[model samples]
Target: MAEDFTPPISQMQSTTLTDDSIQFENFSRRVLIKNIVGRPDGGVGLAGKKVTVGGWVKTGREQGKGTFAFLEVNDGSCPANLQVLVDASVSPLGDLVPTGTCVLVEGELKKPPTGTKQNVELRVCKVLEVGPVDPVKYPLPKTKLTLEFLRDVVHLRPRTNTISAVARIRNALAYATHTFFQKNGFLYVQTPIITTSDCEGAGEMFQVTTLCTDAEKVERELKQNPPPTEAEIEAAKLLVKDKGGMVADLKSAKASKEELDASLSELKNAKENLSRLEERSKLKCGIPQKDGKIDYTQDFFARQAFLTVSGQLQVETFACALSSVYTFGPTFRAEHSHTSRHLAEFWMVEPEIAFANLEDDMNCAEAYVKFLCQWLLDNCLDDMEFMVKNFDKTAIDRLKLVSSSPFERISYTEAVKLLQNVTEKKFENNVEWGIDLASEHERYLTEVIFKKPVIVYNYPKKIKAFYMKVNDDEKTVAAMDVLVPKVGELIGGSQREERYDVIVKRIQEMELPLEPYEWYLDLRRYGTVKHSGFGLGFERMVLFATGIDNIRDVIPFPRYPGRADL
Candidate 1:
């Protein structure tokens, strides 16, 4: 026989107030709806207890021959709403009977009718505060709203069921990520949001600049001290040459070493002055420029910089020192993609482990993913249940499957072969050996062929990032991507190239600037070790957990192309 999951009202009635009640005493002066409604005792334990509650009214209606009203209120602590009964004599019933109206009331907890859905409800004795909302004026009403419509009103969407549930789920995942990494001895490192090195080297980066903000000042300065003309620059160079000749003449005349040194120093100062004049002469009426190049020295940082595409490169430095480290923060990409999986700004959880290989990388990725799934199942079951009830019915099952099952692993070559063999369905992208697997191909492997999470490794060198370790065959790199059912690729990782020569060759072969990566190469120069790491797109993870189709809806304040609403 199966055990009864529901707790009896009698069992709940025996509960007593504890530390949680004491903590919120000074701060809120009210019981949170989640505590009263979500308690195992069904709030029966606190029946007849006088408590103050504050929340926005979700729905309210006049009843009992128009003498009183019942308002369903939620404080965003949980999915369930607490029922509050207010009499017409207590306050203006009209003010308390509108949706979105906020209220603070002193009430007595009382048991609802035995067969009712709610185990307890609040009977209000005094209305302390009423933040009324005019039904005709409020934008959000008691109606079903599409996620696309809510994006326009991002600030108020959290009050909705879908967004609130997603918020809770997202929070749970972040907390779980920190807990898992910290428990495994991984140090959390804060990587810079503005970085000089492009981690992907793709050049799709948002340039961080103050030039546009100070365009007026730059234009004014340009007019006040216009850049020197070609003739002026030539004149300065001639003067520098004359100074050099004088210094040389002093040396030829067998003058004292100090006198010769003084002449040489004067020449150096003259050359510097000429250079400064030439630089000032090049400044245009728009952005500062020199020799047709955007002079970032005039901009902030004294060099080119951009919002980071990934924290992997910076965190790798810390990993080399700490042995194991991770960075969790917002990363930006300037891809013009408007797809369901892309975001202009999104968070990334990147973990780099020293002395780990591709296999170890895959294991860590799998384990961390499974840990997140289990964490949601354990700590956020209520929100998960709400999501299952509304958004995705299979969400809970999917979590269970991922949490318990070991992910399937295959080489990139094997995956391509398998994909090609599937003749029943024609793929949009070609399934060739060296071609990069598209989302369609990835989904087919995880959803159709394997029907589970799949880890594809040993990707072709030409298709992967330059930092990935090249295999012995020299044809492919030791890279891996973890593909799940709904989201094709959730995690991308690889064992870094530890050999100094190999990495330099890879960089040169890719035609990337070696100067930007000099610091990264220094890690190999001094103390090189076989290290592996992976990055999990945080928004994609939220989309997977919530069953929310659009990536924009999962994040609190989404940033996409031409859309950065509050």
Candidate 2:
């Protein structure tokens, strides 16, 4: 049934090219390669029409005994290339045949010979522009290159088939996410990328500071007033002792009340001045320090801040007010993980639903993921076919399975038991009731035990975030993780703890500083209602749909442990 759901290429071609033909008559604009050759008819109906086209040459070769050249050009609007036949009389064949050459030409669309695979070809009439490329210098050649090799050439990787397909798939997924949330009446909220609170409370946030840029100013200040030596500190202490002695002497002399009070005031001022000098003497020639702690008061934000790990806390405020809201933006982590699934920076789609519980959260996450899977199948089949051919063979089947089947739901205890009972494969990590599920465990549950997506809910409170609702049994929290094959956990969500007292207790139990989360708890303080939300890693979704092994390849410019190449 999934294979039967093919995109109507002929209809798409007729509609797009027909409109382009009319536009050419009116405005005379250049046509996109997708509109020209992407249709099921292979652009047969538009023959004889002169049009302007521009793209980089993928491959070119001299033909007809070196009198002309045939060039395969692509503009990245589609995966397909347009065949252009350029005669020697129009332009030099030597410059046009090199791979990665950019060209713009006026050509007449003509039907190719009947036996060829392409239905139509472009016959160049005039050359307009040429941005030549040196075949020896171009990083991308016609030969296949591994994705790892492509990372070194991030800027040019999109020109490759794999990267281009990933880009289109990523774009389709993003569009599907917005469409799915908006259609379901969720308000799109833009949460701050730089936040004061670490949503995960893991203390693994990239500190955002201006200290590096303002280092010179700090150094100059310390140079101007250097820290005092031990001898100077002792002298200041002596001054404070002398001031105390003067105050005591005045009190013992039995002088007039006003005169004694004046002496006491002078002594107090002397002691205060000594204390201030002693404190200034501790200043170092680096980031401002107070009591051996990095003083964030002098930083840009006047307090400690970091790139947001998640937008759940910020979006929850909007959820409490608006009933349903979602924030889709880039988030950062300071993790040094070099695993295929970890990234220093990535985008997250977090949707907060007010008046919902764990069951509602699981249902919403499953439906949203299914919507994305079906969207790619419906609109991006061409790219999907390319992925299926070159990458994983089961990618399409997996998409169809996830899109059509209902996810299996079970408690965390049951999931642990299922893994415990399994004797077919030995898990790398030991199965336990309260320990966090490792990626090996999650994959085994999805790929081996279930053969489908599994939603494991009600995890132990000790292993989950503090905001998750604590069950009445006091052992497990209302949390859930949706694990799929290949990718471990696709979504993590829970019904938020609404009781202010319980949340305070949980915060203390987790040993987290409560000040940073005061605003988040304010949602519970004022007219709190039941709410739930989940965060879906956008790159992980792409990995699942495309069967891409490494998460970095799916994201355009991946930020990882030591790599942020453009």
Candidate 3:
């Protein structure tokens, strides 16, 4: 008898919809985008209007005589959720409706029962079946779930409440960013992605290469199949000689191997050959020799290039020309950071202001953040509500805090002093006056010491960028980083070192080549002015705003190291 029995729930509801039956003209209320989500007050009260709402059905529940399906409908214009109740037995096309289908609810609007959670619920009149949805195969289950679980199903996350909310808030941040810059008279700029200059000065970068050459692929095949035996090494050397050089030109423009044998051949020979030959090879290849001088000719470009870690340097040049310029685009870092906060490729919003100093930069960052917060409150209430209910309940309160209070500012020296004296000691890099503050130290200062966001400034010159202006003491630079409670460091900035001689001397002292940054130094020689700017990790800011902890969650299609699944 148990084997013959079936679950009563399976027989309850069965209707589906698609693009065909969703008649736009028949929807009693041809709802405009703004009315449905943007402004509820302006919408003809859902109480008595004859309306039709169309969206992907979330779940359907049945209880004997009636059926209820919670419709998570969106026009993709906003994050507002419109719940439609379908008790279609007495209405048209109700008997066959199923969950997880495209739905068009032609109904009479009524306020949800006085005690229920939703403000308005559409009472279904005519249900249109336009497509089919299989419950078991559907991505979103009708059960309560968590964001962590949803992340594993990356494709389905966008349909979940937390992700839905994240999407809206992310959009709001983008809009706010543009609006803040535009209103402030800053020229919105788009920088190149495939740039020749590694703006961050950090060596970590994803090398862009074309398709693999037949010779390169063959070399790669030999390395993988037979392993590097003595014969394979000799064969590789022969191939290098035969191909004239590395497979760069031979490889197709669309494919690239990780390391071409030709490039590696030079290194292998240098290692195995005589001291004189090794020295000559190192010079010819421009390769770095241990305890030896830099070989210029061997350097690609007879120079160096890597993915930019920050746009501040490049954007600063524009600021010199435009007096006020901002760059909002992708920045990359090559650090082997296997952490949530660091991404190999992340978006940064950097603003450079001419004739401005540290104070001006702080004001701009604060004002920009505040404007974004206010914009989210006004524009993304639905997303905000969804996040509060599903992701983090404290997110709304945090945004409010940002809007109402001025962010605190402290010097790096003071931060060091505070950390050194703290009774509770768990710092991995023990707090010292001149040492760089690790992420743990930053969190302690921002989350515990201040109990609010704080900007720590004037870091020791040794740890900061070379362009930062040296302070009166000469040991510290006019650098600052804004730290939020959970998001450790949100922004890093400085008043640029503008004097030509000072910058040159600093470069020399830092042991970085004057030749590579010759163009950058020319700015000071020509018409350099007092200027300041900061680089804000755009994704991190979104994380702060939406209460999404993982940096990967904020970015759409994240490209972290060794992970490039679209």
Itemize residue pairs with steric clashes in candidate 1: 12-41, 227-281, 228-281
**Model 3, stretches more than 4 Å misplaced?**
1-34, 37-44, 62-80, 85-99, 105-107, 111-118, 123-131, 211-305
Q: Write model 2 residue lDDT over 1-566, tens digit each, in one string.
A: 55544334442343444623522311335777877787667788788889889889999999999899999999887788999999999999999999999999999999998899887899999999999999999999899899999989999999887899999999999999999999999999999999999788788999899976677765787788776678877887887788788778877887889988888787788778778778877655666778999878989999999999999999999999999999999999999999998999999999999999989999999999899999999999989998899999999999999999899999999999998999988888899888899999999999988899999999999988899999999999999999988898999999999999999999999889999899988999999999999999999999999998999999999999889886
For residue 187, model 1's alpha carbon misses the true position, in angstroms, by 0.5
- What candidate 2 gets wrong by more than 4 Å, as runs, is 1-28, 217-284
Residues 362-475 of candidate 1: C-alpha lDDT, one tens digit per residue: 999999999999999999999999989998999999999889988999999899889889989988788899998999999999989988899999999998898999999999
Worst 10 residues of 1 by lDDT: 19-28
For model 3, the run of ten residues with the poorest summed lDDT: 18-27
Backbone clash count, each prediction separately: 3, 0, 20
Evaluated at residue 493, the lDDT of candidate 2 is 94
| Two-way lDDT contest, 2 vs 3, winner | 2
Residue 288 of model 1 has an lDDT of 75
lDDT of 2: 0.89
In candidate 2, how many clashes are counted? Answer: 0
Q: Would you estimate the TM-scores of all the predictions?
A: 0.85, 0.85, 0.74
For candidate 1, the per-residue lDDT at 246 reads 93
